[model samples]
Target: MDMKKYRSTMKRILGCISRYQWGVAASLACAFVTVILTLYVPILTGRAIDCIAGAGAVDFPRMWKILKQIGIITAITAASQWLMSHINHWVTYRVVKDIRTQAFNKLEILPLKYIDSHSHGDMINRIIADIDQFSDGLLMGFTQLFTGVLTILGTLVFMFSMNPAITIVVVLVTPVSLFAAGFIARRTYRMFKMQSQTRGELTSLVEEMLGNQKVVKAFRHEADAQEQFENINEELRIWSLKATFFSSITNPATRFVNSLVYASVGIAGAIASINGLLSVGQLASFLSYANQYTKPFNEISGVVTELQNALASAARVFELIDAKPQVPEDPDAAVLNNARGEVSLEHVYFSYNPEVPLIEDMNLKVLPGQRIAIVGPTGCGKSTVINLLMRFYDVTCGSIQVDGTDVRHMTRQSLRTNYGMVLQETWLKSGTIRENIAYGNPEASEEEIILAAKEAHAHGFIRRMPQGYDTVISEDGGNLSQGQKQLLCIARVMLCLPPMLILDEATSSIDTRTEIKIQKAFSKMMEGRTSFIVAHRLSTIREADVILVMRDGHIIEQGTHESLIFQNGFYAQLYNSQFAV
Candidate 1:
């Protein structure tokens, strides 16, 4: 990520802090107090040492006073530190949860193009693994940063009071430690960033391969898959090692600078004590403060290391959050309630990529209650027709209108709710059979659900399940046969009973016998509704009220099936090829 994006990512973290300021403020305040109390202990300990080592015989009374002060400070330090930790944990997790929720909500509004371009595993990694790293590192990182800084500053005040000359050595040497940390940080951040991206690639590979594991096994591509995975994993290992190798350099580098500072302070203090410029007690206390002062550098350097990883992961997560959503919704959008199902495309032009111009200068109109079957070769804009009509991707130029109002005028919810769809690929969440059937109409009663299932011919097999409609379906409905899943999807659409319907190869997975049975059901259900069927099976759509033949981006022929066959154009060629086989 560039500096602009990094700053944007940090602003997001600052936003989290702002949102939960009360909790963070409490944590910061506790951290501040804890460091102050901790600094007091070292000063008190040195006082006791000077009292015993000087002329008096033990100075028992004075020693008791010093010990009591140290004990009180220690107790407060422990309590305050505990409070700071608890608050930090609460704020960290809440921020993480908020971030994940926002990302998911963004997905719902993002353009299909964005989702299509990104890998599923990469998206998942941002939500889960990257967010986890950010939370762990960011929470502790800020806490330590606050304490380390306050500890250094407080110790500096005392050091200067005891000996200004020695304070100069301490102050000057500290920057060497910081400079080393900064140099190492700059190098390690790039390494960690690359490692984070590699981890996402590995995750994407695993998700892709595992999802298609059956295909892999059937083709016996296990060795090739393994080889591919090993390559990605090896790349990840190299980046991870390089990141670790660079981050590891900071601790020793900071410690070494701090060691020099410690030795110089010790020598200067002893010489000052001999010259009577500093008392034994003051010299002891200054040395203690000097040691405490430099300790935070080592601690800060360690925190910085973890922080680099956090920042890298955070940038990835924020990338998703910051991504622009699909085209903005119209401000004064109208609603298409009680839809008449009259849809039209006027002077339409569209392309997945504008330069390619997959569709151009198209116009079409459909009356209510028409069963329109759109047929074409693969990639001939058959499915694209459904996509545009459903407003998944808006037309590049011109407008799509429903009920005489441009689709852009209607709220997508209002426009889409009027139509029901079942696509070539079936999707089912992990839920009960009944829930899957009732997906489009969650309020559908048991009788209504069963009636829809019977219409789609899924009721028979559903009854054979050990738990009937109550049986739970696994993810993607993997537990059921493809035909079973298709039937369930059809049943879902039937339950919705929208004014318009889209069946994009909806029955492709069913056996011919079952398909015929369901066709009969669909024929009856198509009454008084606009239905667009993108069918590959020529025989199945022969009864369509109108057959629209498409090639490239244009409809090459349009008429009833018999008329199209008589015309002997593209539709005739397609129909003859299928029937002759």
Candidate 2:
């Protein structure tokens, strides 16, 4: 990531941490106390050594007091470490939870196009794998990092108090070790970044394969799918291997440097002891402090590696959080109240991609309570109109108005609340049948839910099920037929009772008989409501108040179904083709 982006991400993470500042402060304080106790061990060992060397003349009472102090310090250190661990755990968990909740809430506000441009698997990976990686760093890496610094500082102060010459020798090696660690960490971070990206791709591939297992089996494309997956898997393996290899080298290399420094300190201390430059007890204490100093160097190196990995994950997460939604709402947008369902498209032009306009300067009007049928070839932007109407995407140019109010000036939530939609692909959450029906309005009463189900002709089938309206559905309603799933979606939309409804090929997957039944239910639901229907079956649109025949993003013919057939244009040809089949 660029420096500016990295700084921004750090700011956001720090903001998250600041909310739990009290927990963080407590954890840090405990760590400092633990480090203080750790530093006292060398002092206790030194005094015990002196008492032993002094033979019978040594102060037994002083020795006893030193031992007692050591025992007390050890107990306190254990308690402090325990408290620090728990505090760090609680803080990290809460921070991660808040981040996840914010990400989900932002997702709800983001436009559909933002979701469409991103892979579901990758998004899910950010929420799961990325967040998990961050929590590990926050809980373990941050605690160790702070404690290591405290230990190093405490050891240095005590060592200098004993002898500045020996302290200087130990401090001289610090910068070299730190520089080496920084270099290794930078390289390791690059590898970790690549690893996280590859992992996301791998996740996406695996998710796609599992979600389409049935299609893969039917088409006998198992080998092909496996080959594709192997490519992504191989990339992930390479990245992981590289990251592990580099990260592993850091610890061993730091250990080697530390060993060299310890050897030097041992040689220097031996000379100092022989020359009477240091007491035997002081020499032992100096050596202990040397060991303590080198240990944090090793810890620092390890933490650097961990911090790098976390930074990589954080970068990925921040990318999602920082991304601008495809369609942004105006800051001064107004809330649209109780719409009358009259909609007008004044010279409207739109496209998923601006380079290719799907609807060009198309003007149309639908009076309140009118039922309009839209028919066209597969790529004629039939669904795109629904997308634009719902503001899932904004028009590239021109304007769309609802109830004489410009949609662009209205809050997206309020604008969308005025309409109900039944997509071609129905998605039902894992819940009871009644729960699914009331999904549009969670506060809806049980009676209202049943009434909507009855209107959509879904009540009969639901009643026949083992649990009737209480029958629990699986995710995506796998237990129900396509027609039944469509009916459930219809019932969901009906319960909302929006002023406008859009049914985009909602019955296309059903059989002819089921289609007729669903059409009847839809007819009842659409009464006195502005409705837009997009269907391939001409028979389904014949009763529409107005029929619009679109091709190549333009309305080539439009009129009542009978008038269009009488005109013998594109609409007439479409009718003849469907009836002939």
Candidate 3:
């Protein structure tokens, strides 16, 4: 519906195609040759038939020469078409490959907020399904589209040369076919666009349901889920049918109009032949040219349908590619090297939405090796603080500095690489346990990986598996228990030996006894390293040098546990509530 987006999408598709323009140019040349051969062969055949019609006597030598020419030209036309098909296919697939690569690379640099806001399954469709449709239509359009146009043009020029009167008849009826094709194409495009979007919705619904099958079964919502899926599936089916119906009408519409043109040319040519204005052989050639011209009208009408489908797919892909990244990294950003773990927030202000300000003019200073614990009720900005600290979302005002330099002045990768993080949500890729642990520091040795695993109490469980450290975990570690997955994630950070660490309810999945043991291990690990601990269980941070008690996005109280308990404020009451049970 947006003309500007349509133009932009077409321009980008053209750009990808132009990468192999030399090949495309060669293919076009082949197609042109094929068109000429097609026109010439028909002329030769018609001339042979006219030799007998005119003389009423067999001109054996002349007829044989004409037949020979026809045979050779037909062979050449077939070869030229083959070349065209080959070149078009090779160039088309390569262009598609480049497009997919660029799209995937764009995702890597895209802002997290964009990924979070967009449906993941819709994105998958753009990457896979939509691109495939675009490729198929593009390839067909490339070869057939150009060939049909040239055939029409070459045939028209020959028709005019032979008989201008019949040429006018051919041109007059051409508009009817064009009009029909254009009308049908417009409606088909709308339907195809709707179909593409509906397909994305269906894919997203499937992904969401499959990912949360546990919740659906636990809530006994099978029938409800099936109904929802059916609703989306039926919507996709309706749009798909409508699009197919509209496109299918095109070939028949063009055929009906073209048949009128074909019939008129035949009747007109016969009259011209009766008179002496056109020779018998020439009139025969003219009829062949008329058939040639009208046939392309049919082929091109079909191509129009394909072109619309391609453009619809291209529009979706270009929209995703053009999405602006979260925040651009500074060209002259500082490189953080061997950071000493000192962090300071100065007059910071932040909010997910500017109208509803959350963290307001906040200030915090952390020493190089201090163990800082941040505690608060749900939605009290506990996680927002970490998000800001990690520069996932920058402070709306003021600055967060690492080691003496503003975090904004450092590259995100360099800044984040220095800190190790373990969250309650454990993420494990499809790889062996050894690979997961060494993900942060790929160069870590086998000995270092084992030591880190042992410290997390994961070494024993991992060794008991059939393949030990080489056991490949399924996607999301579906084969492992929650606690085992959590331990593997912790072991990953332990191997990194980062300059700073953040534990965000990292032990929530483990049993109480195991959590206590891991807590002791973490306490030992924190002897000289700076750590940021976030917990609902205040008991875990009993030995923290400082505890920040947050309420409504501000630190309502700040001190050691004994000091905060003596104050008998929000921190003391919150700590007391836990033991009340």
- Tell me how candidate 1 scores on lDDT: 0.89
Better of 1 and 2 by lDDT: 1
lDDT of 3 by residue, 395-479 (tens): 8899999999999989999888888899988899999989998989899999999999999999999999989999999988989
Kindly report which residue stretches of model 3 are placed more than 4 angstroms away from their true locations once superposed.
Answer: 51-56, 277-284
What is the number of backbone collisions in each predicted candidate, taken in the order shown?
1, 0, 0
Candidate 1 lDDT, 1-581, residue by residue in tens: 36776687788788976889999889889988998888777678878887788664789898998899888888999999999988888888898899889888889998898998899999999889998888878776767888899899988887887678999988988889989998988788788889999999999999999899999999999999999999999999999999899888988998899889889888998999899887777777887787788888888888888888888998988889889898887888898897998988899999998678788888889998899999999999999989999999989999999999999888999889999999989999999999999987889999999999999899999999999999998999999999999999999998988999999999999998999899998987888999999999989899898888888998888999999999988889998998784
Candidate 2, residue 546: lDDT: 90
The residue ranges of model 1 lying beyond 4 angstroms of the native Cα positions read 279-281
CA lDDT scores, all candidates in order: 0.89, 0.86, 0.89
Name the lDDT of candidate 3: 0.89
Give the winner by lDDT: 2 or 3. Answer: 3
* Model 2: lDDT to the true structure: 0.86
Between candidates 2 and 3, the TM-score winner: 2
Q: Please state the error at residue 323 of candidate 2 in Å.
A: 0.8
What's the TM for model 1? 0.97
Note the residue pairs that clash in candidate 2: none
Model 2 off-target regions past 4 Å? 1-5, 326-332
Q: Could you tell me the lDDT of residue 165 within candidate 2? A: 83
TM agreement with the true structure for every prediction:
0.97, 0.96, 0.96
